[model samples]
Target: MFESLGAFVDHLRAQGKLVDIDEELSPDYEVAAAVRLIDQRLGKAVLCRKVRGCGMPVVANILARRDLLRLAFASPNDPTEEYLRRIGGSLPPEVVRAAPVHEVVHDGDFDVAKLLPLLLHHEKDAARYISSGVTVSRDPQTGLRGMGIYRIQVCGPRELTISIGSPPVSDFLAKANATGKPLPVAIAIGLEPLSYFASVVPVAAGVDKFDAAGTLRGAPVPLVAARTQPVEVYAEAEIVLEGEMLPNTQREDGPVGESTGYYHAGRSWAARLTAVTHRAHPFYYALVPFAAENTLLMGVTREADLLAALRRKFPSVRRVSLTQGSVAMLAIIQAAPASKEEATAMVRAALEGSMQVKTAILVDADVDPHDLNDVQWALSTRFQADRDLLVLRDLPGSPIDPTATNRRTAKLGLDATRPADQAEAFMRIALDPAARRRVEEILARLT
Candidate 1:
């Protein structure tokens, strides 16, 4: 397990998965443009050594691909299985006396925009955003800790607006607001992969994400108390912003591009920044909203959980794929269904299990769920819309879904598995093994 984000970055550099840019770049659009170009060409994480105005360097696209996710866990095998194994248990975090985050603390005379390299990713973005800050909070009554990735809008030097959506953190803020008290919050930037993964997973209310993160790392995560808040943050985090979500207060927050590839109008609630602390010469992490890294970061853990949830109900479920291009709205399942009834049941289970999954397609175990072409082939040959289509209307849906009306939308499922009686008719054409081997040998010599 990595001790800090710096360690993870170093590991990525050693593996040739990261690139360093010595050229100066502006935080507004230049840094984001460079990241997008590199993501399209090389798909490597970038570390910009100099920014136009900021003192700290900026890093982007840290988890842009599945291979990088595997590398984060130091696992060369299946990433899903590795992720499942890591988060299967829980371990409480350990508190430490000192932390790198508190090495340089600024309680007064601080300007967030001037100090940090916040990025303006899209052309229509209202302002620079903190897209990757893992906001941490706790229940005032039960003292249950919650962590989540929230969009923080830079409104002023000490004031910011936050998007508190459907997550545990929102609930915590609500409970605190009921008491007419500002909810204490700590935003940790540049965290290790395990901590970041745990923050995004859907867990029960009152569940501590730090414990979950410790479990994923196979060791207890070290925590240090924030300088300006009661909340504790990852001791090794590169930067930590301590603040409070003001009660009965709201402001314009966005029109910023989200992971769903659309601009969401700004929310009302705002956070009052109290202190900004960081390690000396910290790395400013930037996550370009609607990018590959944004999709994978949100979808990978959800896919693993969905796979486990489906297998518990249907043993025949071999694999589950939350298609990256669909932004996690589409799910493809590879399973061996005994009959049409069983295939339909599996589809229903998948839809019921994951609220974000709007489209589900069930294929035979022979078809690769991860391969879009193979899934499409199954849909073409085995699926009959009249007999296999399952549609649910007027259901609660994701707010990001453009088709959703009044927060409700329709769900579609297709059973693409071949009929049991017509197995021979749907058999796939195969290449002779001896002839394929001979061809491979000839090609190898030619190369």
Candidate 2:
């Protein structure tokens, strides 16, 4: 696996998976527009060498596609499975005296707005956001470190409003607020792809997110003490913004376009930036919300978690996919069940496995869960509304879902497996082995 963002970018360039944009682009909307267009076309990540006013370059769409993820994980097979295997255990981080991120330090008075190329992702966004920075904090009570990607609005040169929506960051913030102390935080931007992916993995309480990154790296992740904050950041991170989340300080920080493809307005906790440190010549990373990268980064780990959970309950569960078009609100499970009851049970297990999943579909083992066509076919031919459709009401759901009512939403499960007794009657036709091979060989030569 690549060790640093620079190394990964270099490797991607070598593999023709990265594009260089020499034209000066504005961070207001042009950069985000280019990232969106590239993602929509399944194109390479862009390296914008010139921003209108910023000194550093901007990079976006770093890992928007499955092929890019495959490169980062160095997996010959499924990257999600590889991630699952790596996360089974963790390697502790190795602290060092100094690192490249501290090559340039600005602790006193600095203007973040004029320094970094923060992107304005959507037209309706309240302000330019540091959308890709991984917020690293330590639990005040347990002393365990945690990392999470959060929406950080640029309030001023040295001020930010962060939405502490989930745990263990929220849990840490509560403990700090209980004692009336500010929670020390270090926002690391432009980290290795694996470290960013590891941050979003739903590890259990008391588990250090840094250790998860180490596991994904297959070696200890190097760490360095922050210049101003009482926290450690990945030594190779391109930039680190050291700060503290003030206790009992609230700020109105909303109307930002979220991954759900809607504007979400809410209150947020205020943070005072103490310092900003980075490499002398750094690259600012930007992530466009509601884009492919946002969905893939959040979906893959959830799919792995759901697959593991379902398999533990039902050994017949073969594959699971968090459909991207649904923004991971829908799950498709491929499994072999002995009866209709077993299929329905598997679907329920999937929905319960992750709060993000609002709809689940269980298809026969022959169906490919990742393929929408295959899943739709199974739903059309094998499912009956009265017998196979299950609706669950008033269940807990992710608040980001705009369709949800007061954080409560209804869920659905569709069993698309063929009737067990009539399985023989529902057998699918297949091409003859010799004929198929001959046709494939001819097609290959023509291509």
Candidate 3:
């Protein structure tokens, strides 16, 4: 696998996946418009070599494609299951004494507007935002590290308000707020895409996320200490920001766009940018904020985590997939024959793990859960509305949920799994293997 961001870019280029734009596009809308449309439409990685206001080129939509995802995995089998099995539980990262991020530092009286590309995305957006900020922090009590991708809107050259919502990391910061202590954090940008995605995993509270990265890469992630803050960072990252979440500090955070494709309500929270640090030639990653790929990442995380939770109750569960473009609410799971009771239990168990799972699907092993058409066909053929549909009300609506209505949203479950050893009606059929291969070969010649 490619070790660094540049190597990954080279890999993408070799595969003709990266689009390098040399045009002088303005950061206000020109550059952002291309990023938004390319990311939302093509779903491929793009690199803008020139920006109107910023000194650096902005790269977005890198993680938008499954080809990049496959490269990140580098495995033949499905990356989702491969990822889940590889990094379900992991250990600490390898901390280096010093590296590139520490070589350049911004101390007191530093001006961020001169260094980073804090671009304004939308017309109504309040101000510029570091759209790709990957926050790195530690749990105060448990001392466990927390890495997540969240929005940070710029309030000043050095200040931005954060929206962490009610997540585990948020809860940890909440505790820090009660004690009058500011939470130390490191924001890393332009790291490996695997590292970036690992930052967003929903690990056990206080459990490290880098372990997942290490597991995916088959090696420990090299880390370096930040000069301005008491936190460690991935040394390979092009840029790093040292900051602290302020105690009882509040500012109007949102009205900036989110992954939900809507400018939801804004809240106030205090986030202090103590110092900005980066390499001599840093490549900044700017995401088209509301892209479906981001939503898919979140949905996949919830699905994998749900599979882990359901395995304890229904070990027969073999495969699962959360549907794309759900706003992160629905899922489909494929399992071998267990009991009918076990199928129902698996659905309920998944909901408990991810409250955002508004729809859970339990399908027999023959069904390809990842393919939406096949799963929907199963629903249409085997299911009737009143009998097959299962709904749960008053469940916690996850933060990204727009129709949350105060986190009270309805959930649905489909028991599409077949009865054990009962192949009479549920048996899957297909043409003979050799005969199908011959047909495909003939079709290939003609087409």
Per-residue lDDT of 1-447 in model 1, one digit per residue for the tens? 787778888999999999999999988799988888887789889899899988898887878888888887878967778888777577999999899999899899799887788888899999889998999988888888888998889899989888887678888888888889999999998988777767787777667877888887888988888988999888989999999999968898778888888888856678899999999979888888877888788788888889999999889888888887898889999999888888899998888778788999999978999899999999999999999999988777766788888868889999999997788898999899999999999999999
How do all models score by TM-score? 0.93, 0.94, 0.87
Q: Give the range of the ten consecutive residues with the poorest summed lDDT in model 2.
A: 344-353
Candidate 3, after superposition: displacement of residue 231 in Å? Answer: 2.1
After superposing all C-alphas onto the true structure, candidate 3 shows an RMSD in angstroms of: 3.2
Candidate 3: which stretches are off by over 4 Å? Answer: 108-110, 139-144, 166-172, 336-353, 416-447
Considering only N, C-alpha and C atoms within 3 Å, which residue pairs clash in candidate 1?
251-268, 254-266
Question: After TM-score superposition, what is the CA distance of residue 141 in candidate 3 from its true location, in Å?
Answer: 5.8
Q: What is candidate 3's lDDT per residue for 31-56, written digit by digit as tens?
A: 67888787766767888898777777
Candidate 1 displacement at residue 252 in angstroms: 0.8
Name the top TM-score candidate: 2
* Candidate 2 residue lDDT tens string, 1-447: 777898899988998899899999999899998888887885578898998988899888888887888888878768778877888687899999989999999999898887799888899998888889899999998789888998899999999999887887999999999999999999999988888788787888888877877888888888899989889888899999999999989998878988889888888999999999999888889898988889999889988988888888899888888887899889999888988778878878777767889999998888988889999999999999999998988888976788889888889999989998897899988899999999999999999
